[model samples]
Each structure stands twice: as C-alpha cells, then as structure tokens.
Target chain A: MRSSAADRTRPTPLDGLVVLAVLAAAAAIFYFFRPVSGNFLTARIVLDNELVAELPLSDLTEPVTLEVPGVRYPITVEGENGRVRVLHSDCPSQDCVHTGWVSRSGGQIVCLPNRLVITVTGGAAEADAVTG
Target chain B: MTHSVRRLTRCAVLTALALAISVCEGLVPLSVLIPLPGLRLGLANLVTVYALCRLSGRDALGILVSRCLLGAVVGGNLTALAFSLSGGLLALGTMWLLLRVPGLSLFGVCIAGAAAHNTGQILAAMGVLASPAIAIYLAPLLAASVLTGAVTGAASILLVRRVPFDEGKP
Candidate 1:
C-alpha cells in the first residue's frame, strides 16, 4: 500500500500536449517534404557512392539491366512515360524492389548492402541530355 | 532475501525480461507489416523506463546495454548491433537528462528518448552509407517514434503506478 516516489510525480495534461505538438511538427515536416510531381524524367543510379548511370525515363523503348561491379546481382531498371522502377535485384532485403515505380522528384530507393541507390532528379537540361 | 542479493536478482530478472521482449519483438516482422525500414515498437524500453523511474540510473543503463547486445546476438545480425548500440546509448542519455526536467513526466522523457534514438540511428546510417541524403528519412522516423514512444511511455507509467518496484531502490 506504499506509493513510490515515481507515483508521486504525476504527469499533467501538459505532457500530453507537448507530445502532441511534437507529433504535429513531425507530420508537417513529412507533408512538406513528401514526393512531388515535377519534371522528374531521369533516374540516376549510384553504386558505391559513384554515379553509375542516368537513364531518361521518357526514352526507354525497352528495359535495361545494369550489372554494377562488386554487387552480387544485376538491377533491371524499367520505365515508361515519366516513371521508373527497379524491376529486379538480387539484394536479400528486396527493399528496392518493393519500392516499386518512382515517378516524382525526390523519390529514392536504396539497397544498403549492395550500396546501390536509385533516385529521381528533376531538371530541364539533365532531362534533355538524357533523352537526347 | 538479503538486500544486496535482492537487488541483484531484480536486475537480473529485469534484464532477462527486457532481452526476451527485444528478441520477441524482433520476430514480429513489423517492418514487413508496415513496409517501413528500421521501425519497431521498442517494447523493451518499457523496462528501461521502469528501471529509470523505480531503480537507479546505473541499473537502467545496465539493463539497456544487456538488452541491446543480447537482442542483436539472438537476432543474428552484427550490422544491427552498431545501430542498436548507438541508438540505445543516445536514448538512454536523453532520457536521463529529460527525467530531471521540472514539469516533464516520463511520457515526455520517453518521447524525447525515442526521437533521440531515431536521430542516432539515422546518423549511423548516414555514416555507413557515406551520404547525407539519408536525413530525408528523419521525418518519417520521427513520426513513427511519436506513436511508439507514446505507447511505451504510457505503458510504463501505468506499470509504475501498479507495480511496487521500491524494494530494489538504491
């Protein structure tokens, strides 16, 4: 029937209010940074922190498989219109494969073990260079 | 039981419980269910909070380190050990500081700790990847932390209210 010191220090509603404020701020940040549709016509593939390939999504007449050195499996990048995706990968987690099509600026899919990253970039000159 | 022996027993029992919770939570595949990488309920943290409030800070830290090391070993992931250790230590430090604040309760302390944990893990990821773009994951991680931290914090508060852990007080 004895109460501990922890029990004596009761949490006020202010504690809940503070947590709610934090959650709201985090949600707001996430909303503002959410992927947006833009001139994202190219997908840049970086392997081992180096730029491996930059494929124009608009010009893909057929899918292309890129086998970067030092990685266990090849990555198949497929695109149509303005969207791109990793159709296949040999990475164990398959997180990149699960990411599916990314058609907007700021979208990214990372294969950590393979040190591979696929990201969409939006720019007129870069898109033109890749498409041309 | 004698006083010192009783304290040791309590620490052992709490450490084992925390480890069990950590290992069991690892098996749930929360990431697959939620489709979010590095997301977890952090159920074992309840024990850490309980210890921090009821027992000594040293006891809480001991339980936390034991849980992280044993959990990683049982989960069979050496890479995860780095992340967990960095995050766990950061969270523990943050909780220790926040618990001293005047108006803040365990709920606030836990929420801050969770946020700190996420930040530390992201920093570790950035280091391992050699890229700062991983910071983009922070918002989502923070949002997830709010939910999971609240659950664990509230649970700990309820537990501390009901359970008499004063016997092990140092």
Candidate 2:
C-alpha cells in the first residue's frame, strides 16, 4: 500500500508551531537591532561613491542646491525642522525624490543612476540597507 | 493521453501558467500597494508550490527555470534576470528540502522558501552593489518574507486542495 502525495504533504500541528517559532525569532532579532534615536544630526552626501559633503541638519537655515561634477543636474538639499530631504533632482528614476525625507539615522536617499547617496549619520538609525 | 505525452503537456501548461503569472505580476505596481521596493505578493509562487506538491521535482524545476527566464525577458529588465534567477532557484531548492520532512506541511515549506528567496536576492544585491552593508536588510526582509510567504503558502494549499490534478505515480 502506497500513500498519496496529498497524505504525504499533510501538515501536522508541529509544522505550524515550527514556522511560528521561526517568525517570532525573526521579529525578536529585528527588535533587538532596531535603530535607536540619538543626537547625530548630519546628512552625508556621496557622489560617484565618494564622500562629497556633510551637511549639518541643525544649522540649515534655508534650502541649498548641490552641484556634482560631471552630472548635468544639481540636487537640491533642504533642511527644515530637524529633517533633511532631496527636494529636486534630474535623475530618471526620481528615486531620490521619492525618498522624501531623512530625519532619523540610517535613513538614506539613493540615486543609483547618478551614483549619489545621502545618508543620515549620528542618530539611532543603524540599518545599513533598505529592502522591499 | 499516453503517460509520456500527458506528462509533457502538463509540464508545458504549468510553465505557461507560471510565466503568465510572473508577467502579470510585473505589470502590477506591487510597490504602490505594499509601499516597499523589491517586495511583491509573489503570486507566481503559487504555481511552483502546486507543482512541487503534485508533480515530480524534476518537472517542477523545469517549470521554475523556464518561468524565470521568460518572465525576465518579457518584463524587459535584463539586469534583474540575475536576481530573479538566483532567488527563484533558492526558493525552489529550499522548498524541496523542507518537503522531505515528515511532519512539515506545505505552508512551512513555502514560508521557508520565501525566506530563502529574500536571502538569495540580498546576497545577489551585495555582489552587484559591491557593498556588504546590504546585510542590514536581513531582518526586515525576513519579516516581510514571513508575511508574503504565509500568504502564498496559504493560497497554494487552497489551490492544491481545490484544483483536481491527476497524481500519477512519480
């Protein structure tokens, strides 16, 4: 007598428990390494994978446009109310524009085609990568 | 139909369905719906799960590879082909291994596969970007994988139960 594939694949209670345990463990790890809020308040800009400028969000009184060498368009960096953002860019994907603002450490605005990245430093945000 | 011919036809039909789902998924703006980059419902995995449960591992592997190739071409992102291929293969391989566990259900297997897919993609991203910082995404990606994996697994279970497929001897 042979068992059908359906029977072989039937899930037992233990299977559910195991999956639940794995998920819980993942959540725990996320919570443990979660970004912490701190006083680090500078946005570091990198162009062509090189550190170009570091703007202190605390001292920003008005919006400033940054021009990168060899890039046709400039990136408008604005700081307001303890937050920073890329107000404008000439990149095709507009990913930088879509990034909106970075107020916490670990927040980043990456323009892949332009090879530009803006990341907040000296805060509790410690995430080094973004995933979907 | 003769057993050999019937097997071939089944594999073709499953491959076509998988490809269609993959392409259709590309058309939908899953990012808008989920508000996350590189995240999708992974609806195409439904077909893979179904194949794994009902068909031979070889047949499922064929369908998975074909679907990934055709999907990447049709979607017009050749650069993404590497990521998709690595992720899909990792997921399929994980599910295959987990299925051998006696008490493990399809749901758990699928969830594991989903998680593996994310890991594989992240690894690929690290290589492409030439940066190891991408590892920080592991926790979030795992969390997301749990959700997406559960949804896909549940759907696959429903499909396997509801749809009648001839379970011939392997």
Candidate 3:
C-alpha cells in the first residue's frame, strides 16, 4: 500500500528512452572506433613509455618470439602472420597474457604490470585522448 | 532516536553493508557468469541507490565514500582505490542528478550511472597506466555495463520499495 502511492520510485516511461539513448551511444562508439584488420603488419613493442622493439610481421619467415624482462618476471611476446600476442607472463593480473591477440591496426596488447605496450600498425598514429 | 542521530547511524550501516558486498564481489570470478572483461554485477551500488531514493544525497555520498575506502582496505588491494573511487563518485553523481528528473526512477538513473562508472574507471586507468590505448576497452566496457546496470537497477528498485524504513521522510 505504501509503494502504491510512491510511483516516482518505480520505472518510468522515460526509462525506455534513456536506455535506448545509452545503448545507441554504445553502438555508435563501438562501430566507429572499431579497429581495422589486415595489411598493417608492424608490431611495435614499448616498455615504460619507451619504444622497445619493432617486429615486421609481413617479413617474418617464421614465428618470432621475444623474451622480455618485465618488472618482476620475464614476458614472452609472439608475432607471426600479421598477428601478435603476449604468449606468456607471470604478472599477478595476467591481464596482458589474457589479451589474446592483435591482428588489426590500432589494436594493442598492454601489460601494465610490466609497463609494456604492443601496438600493430602500417603507420604510427599518435594516440588520441578522449575526455569523459 | 533524534533525526540527525538516526540518519548518521543509517549511513554507517549502509556503508558497512555496501563495503561487504563490494569485497565479496572482488573475490568472485564473475567472468564465469558473464564471460566479459570489466563487467560486474555492481551489487554494492544498490545500497547507494536505495540510499539516494530514500535518504538525502548527503547520506548517500557518505555511504558511497566510506564503503569504497573500507572495501579497498578490507580487500587488501589499495590499487583498486583509484578505480573504485573514481567509479563510485561518478556513479553517485549521475544517480543523484537523475533522481531529480520528473518521471525517472531507479532504473534509468542506474543505467546512466553505470555507464558513467565505467567511463570514470577507464579515464582513471588511462592516467594510471599512462596509455591512451586503454581507450579501446571503453566501448566494450560501456556495452557490458548496460546489462549490469539493468540488473542492479532492478535490485535497487526492490530495495527502495521494500525497505519501508523512511516512509515518513520527504
């Protein structure tokens, strides 16, 4: 009986409108910002804001593996067939290892624990900042 | 109980309850359920949601802040304070604003707040990790937040309606 009078506390008609607005915004951002796949073959590895290694995926006759000394443990980076991934890492979060793979331009596999970032691209584009 | 004392006690209880929920959430591997990155049920948020709907914004903000801090300390993960603090404040700010709009309720307020929470976390992460590439996670995280927001919003509405603690308050 108490809630019956407090309709303001319940779902309103505008709920649909707001939900649709945010979902539409999410879809637009996802679609427009989606990464581009194919042809961009350089996998640049950066550690601690410094450029570390640049592997040309297109020129690889075989899968190339890099064993980088991370902050606490060694990290393995693998690249081949225009794709790159963190093959292994002992970082507590394992966020970098779980990143799986990157085969597209603007795609990145970052290991924050190791201050490592790997970006694949045909030409390097400066990272763009987005404000909330 | 005097009104001020009662309100203060209620805020403290809400803070403890919210902190416990948040700590438990951190231990649970929710990935098994949602199989998505950066997605959580955000159950603790329901406490703040209920607070805002029933109590004044001041109490709600107090609960949110103390809960995040205690939740981090209890979880023994101070690194989390950055993300949770940013997300919690933004979520509270969004919810507080949305609650004032005519015809809007917990559902819509929480949905927008959840999105804002994710945005705040990403923004903080970009600062912490010093990498703009982290922005790639924003879209996916926001998309995942909608589902979480809906679930939390439902729980929040139930809490707000069933609590019946502050029926006489404005």
**Positional deviation of A17 in candidate 1, in angstroms?**
5.0
TM-score computed on alpha carbons, candidate 1: 0.69
| Model 2 / residue B18 / CA error / Å | 0.3
- State which candidate has the highest DockQ: 3
Q: Write the per-residue lDDT of candidate 3 for residues A1-132, one digit (tens) a residue.
A: 222212455677787777887788778777776666444468878888877678776566688788874455689988886688999998888988877777778778988878888888764442222111
Encode model 1's per-residue lDDT on B1-170: one tens digit a residue. Answer: 58878778888999999888887887895787677778888887788778888777899898888888887778888788889888888888888777776667667777877887887888888787655556668788888888888777778778888876666355
Clashes of each: 0, 2, 0
Over B56-139, each residue of candidate 3 has an lDDT whose tens digit, in order, gives: 788889998898788778878887899999998999998888877777766788888898888888888888876565677778
- Per-prediction TM-score, please? 0.69, 0.66, 0.72
Ranked by lDDT, the better of candidates 1 and 2 is: 1
Candidate 1 residue-wise lDDT, A1-132, digit = tens: 221324544665657776786677677767775656555467888888888778776566676545555676766666666777778888788888877777777778788768888888775556654421
TM-score ranking from best candidate downward: 3, 1, 2
Q: Which stretches of candidate 1 lie over 4 Å from their true place?
A: A1-5, A8-13, A24-37, A43-54, A58-62, A65-132, B1-3, B167-170
Q: Superposing all C-alpha atoms, what RMSD in Å does each candidate have to the true structure?
A: 7.0, 7.7, 8.4
Count: clashes, candidate 3: 0
Docking category of candidate 2: incorrect
